[model samples]
Target: MPRWFYQLASPRWSYEIMGKLLPWFAIVTAALLVSGIVWALAFAPSDYQQGNSFRIIYIHVPSAILAQSCYMLMAIAGAIGLIWKMKVADMVAKSSAPIGATMALLALVTGAIWGKPTWGSWWVWDARLTSMLILLFLYLGVIALNSAIESEATAAQATAVLALVGLVNIPIIKYSVEWWNTLHQPATFTLTERPAMPAEMWVPLLVMVIGFYCFFAVSLMLRTRNEILHRERRARWVRELIEKQ
Candidate 1:
């Protein structure tokens, strides 16, 4: 195993690393989110087609992107826990559930809001929409399963299996617009294609996307740190740290 892997396996080291990283992620999330919102809403030019209503893209796109990314991260964490039996990985998998769920919900609501003006309907059983809903349910199911199991290790194991199974839905969600005759538009940004809009518009969107990721990291670390403390409360290092407080 790599030196870094050993370092990560140490709960004390993981806790200390997160403690150092949390503030940086928090600061970047706040700065980028605030600047991205202001620039996207006020300064960025509106779509020639949708006009002011298209402003919702600033929020909808980033959240939608983050929703999928969060699930991917959560599942990866679960896989790490399952394979290596790493306690920190389990904590990460558990911590990420609520954040992923919230991102999915925000994506759904914002998509609905954006839809009302563009698609002439607030809700639709379109492929992308339905698949995103499924993603939310998957996150919820993981949380529920974790809560239902009494043994922490057993709960983590079960949640890990569920998360791994749910990975199939992710690809479906990604390609739904292309694979199905959906009302939702195709991706505006792709690795193989240039952006649909000019730099003025897409730049802030890029910032927003990066900010959302930073925000996710901040939230995951906060929750994972709490989980570590809770699980390790009886340990000498943790107890000593608590006594110092």
Candidate 2:
């Protein structure tokens, strides 16, 4: 392994690095979110059909995307912990669950709000909607399982297995719109093709997506730092850190 990869296993190193990076991520998140919200709500052209109601996409789309991305990160972090016995990875996986759950909830609530305007109903059994709901439940399950176990290592192992098993749901969520005749629309952005929407609208959406990612990074780092300190409270470095503070 590279020196940097080995360094990542060190809780103190991970915590220090996160502390250093947090400010930058926070700054970027604030800038992009503010700019994106302003550009999206004030400047972007309204959809011909949905009109002003379409502006909600700025929030809905990014939250939905972030929820999925957070799940992936959680699962991957869990895998690393399982494979390498890395405490830092376990902390990251543990920290990710609540944040991911919040993002999923935000996505679902926003989706319902957006759906009410577009589909004329606040709730639907549509494939995409149902799958997204499942995703949220999966996050909650991980969180519940983590808290249920008394041993920290045991809890990490249990949640890691659950997260890995839940990976199957991610693909289902991604393809639900295409595989079924669902009321939900397809993705707004894809790497292979230009967005159907004009530049003026998509630009802000892009900014919002990037901003959401930065926000997630900031949240994860903060949470992970806390986890590290708690888990390593007995360590000399943690004691030193506390004494210095």
Candidate 3:
């Protein structure tokens, strides 16, 4: 085991590190979110076709991207716990569930809103949309399974298995539009290729995407910190910190 791995295994150390890091994520989240919203919603040019309705992409695309990424994080955390029996990893997996679920819900709602004008329907069982809906259900299922189990260790174990099983859906969600005759358009952004849109449209979107990631980082840290405190409530260091607070 490397030194960093051991450092991560220590709950007290991880908690303290997160405490130091939270403020920085919070600051960046606020700055990026504010700038992204203003730039995308207020200043950016309206779409040549959809007009103001297209601005919803700023919210929808970022939410959709974050929704997928959050699930991956939860699954990875769960895997770490299962492999190493790390209590901190279990707590992280548990803390991540609600956040991921919320992001999924946001994605679905914003996608529906974006659909009304462009696709002419508020909701559709299109491939990409359907897969994304399934992703949301998977998130909810993980949350429900965790809540249903009584023992902490048992719950974490169960959640880890379920998260791993649901890993199949991520790819399906990513490729659905491409593989099927879906009403939803294909991805507007990609890493390997340049964006199809002009900078005016994509630049703000890029900012929003990064801002959403920062926001997710902030939420994950806060929730994981709370989970750490609760799980370690009886530890001497935790008690000392609580008393200091």
| Cα lDDT computed for each candidate against the true fold | 0.93, 0.94, 0.90
Quality of model 2 by C-alpha lDDT: 0.94
| lDDT of each residue in 175-209, candidate 2, tens digit only | 99999999999999988999999999999999999
Q: State TM-scores per candidate.
A: 0.98, 0.99, 0.98
Clashing pairs in 2: none
Show where candidate 3 strays beyond 4 Å: none
Report how far off residue 14 is in candidate 1 (Å): 0.5
Q: Root-mean-square deviation of each candidate, in angstroms?
A: 0.9, 0.7, 0.9
What lDDT score is found at residue 197 in candidate 1? 91
Identify the superior model by TM-score, candidate 2 or candidate 3. Answer: 2
Q: Top lDDT: which candidate number?
A: 2
Q: Model 3: what TM-score?
A: 0.98
lDDT tens digits by residue: candidate 3, 99-168: 8888888989988888988988999889888888888898889989988999999999999999999999
Which candidate has the highest TM-score of all?
Answer: 2
lDDT (Cα, 0-100) at 101 in candidate 2 = 95
Better of 1 and 2 by lDDT: 2
lDDT of 1 by residue, 23-66 (tens): 98899999999999999988999899999898888899989999
